[model samples]
Structures are given as C-alpha cells and as structure tokens.
Target: MSGSDSDRESAKNEAIRIIATDTASVLKFYGALEPSPGEEPLPPAEIVTPEWALFRWVQVQLLMSLDVFFRYRGRVPEASALTHCWYEKIEHDFLDAEYLVLGVLEGAFATFERKLQAYWQMLRPDGVLMS
Candidate 1:
C-alpha cells in the first residue's frame, strides 16, 4: 500500500472506533448493552472494532425503522436518532479514498464543508470574490 492509502485506512479504523464506543456508551446508559439471561458481557476490545461498528450501524438502522413506526404515537422524532453520514462517508472513502484522512472529515460533512471553507475565505465581506 502507498502512504496515502495507509492513511485512509487509519482514518476509517478510527471512525470505527468512535462509532462503536459511542454506540456502546449510549446503550449502556439505557441498560440496553447489558447481557441478558445469564449471558456474559463481551470483552472490551471485542466490543470496539470494525466488525462491531458495522453491527451497530445495522442495529441503528433497525432501530430507525422501529422509530418510523413508533414516532406516529408521539408525533415527534426520537431524540436518539443517529445519523449515518459519518459512517457512510468513511466507509465509502475507505473503499476508494480521493483525499487524505483529514479531507474525509472536512469534505464529507454535508459534502461541502471544505468547499465553503475554500471560498468563504475569499469573501471580502461585500459578497465579492477576492480574485
């Protein structure tokens, strides 16, 4: 692998780490992560990995489907709604990265954060491009 490719992998793995950790923390807060019916809790490292992140990603999707059904009763969205924008961007970029790791975080947020940053800096405050 090339230098840039290795960097992309590192970024994806880091994203996996973050998503897994956050999902577990949220579940634990609600006692949903606890083992049931005499089952043993998973090991620390086992719960936070690429595989677990993917699992939780799917799990979240299922929960969202449930929300779609349940939200009608409350007439409001769930406060626990999770967005997949981060997971999606990282996963796609990991398959074929067009930029460095830093670029993933910068560009994939709503798909235009860096574009705004690139041009916003040129604004003269009079709505004119610097050039």
Candidate 2:
C-alpha cells in the first residue's frame, strides 16, 4: 500500500482503539452503578458480555465517523455531509442496540442501571443522537 493508504489505515486503527477504550470504560462505569448475581456475585470486569462489546464497537464506529466529520468541518464540507449521513445510519442502529442491550438488562434489577440509560438516552431523545 502507498504511504497515504498506510496513514489512513493507521488513523482508522487508532480511532478504533480510542473509541473502544472509551466505550468500555463507560460500560464499566455503568456496571459499577449497580451490583450483580450468579456464581461470582457483584462486580464484573467486562460489564455484561461480548454483546455489549460488539454494540460498543459499532457505537464507536459512529463516534469516529462523527469525529471525522467535525475534523474536516471546515476544509471539507463534503466530509461533513457524508458524516451526517453516517450519523443517521448509526442513529437508526442505536435503537436496535438499546432494545437489545438495555432490554436484556431490564429483567435484572441487579443489572439495570438508570444512570447509564439516561446518559445514552439524553444524547438523542429524538433518536437522532446528535453528538
């Protein structure tokens, strides 16, 4: 690959790493908001499961796209437009994600956390997820 291509790939990986770490920390913080059950009892290192990880992975993708949009907001109007389009896509997916993850957590009083839900929900009450 060319140097430009390599640079792009590097940037993409870095973005993925940053977003993944951020989202995982967010999940951990949410998990800390409440207790749990099972053979282990309480605190979990990973919050829920791989499902949460995957959701966060996608969520970070959306975030990265938005970041790119804002990064090029001035020099590249087209980038912003494209990023807006991706934002809408992620917003659509966020609904299914909420239903899937939060719905799963709903049954477990030990797992259910209002603060986490509120944190994410407040970002996009209209289901558009602006930021």
| Candidate 1 lDDT over residue span 1-131, tens digit each | 23575675575445434432455543443344456788987545445542344343333333333333332432433456535764564365343222222222232322334523332222112232222
Instruction: Give every collision pair in model 1.
Output: none
Native RMSD of candidate 2 (Å):
13.8
lDDT of 2 by residue, 1-131 (tens): 23575686677556544443455654654455543555454446464543454444445434445445545542445554767676775575455455534433332211144533443453323332222
lDDT of each: 0.38, 0.46
Candidate that would win on TM-score: 2
Candidate 2 local Cα displacement, residue 116, angstroms: 19
As a TM-score, model 2 comes out at: 0.27
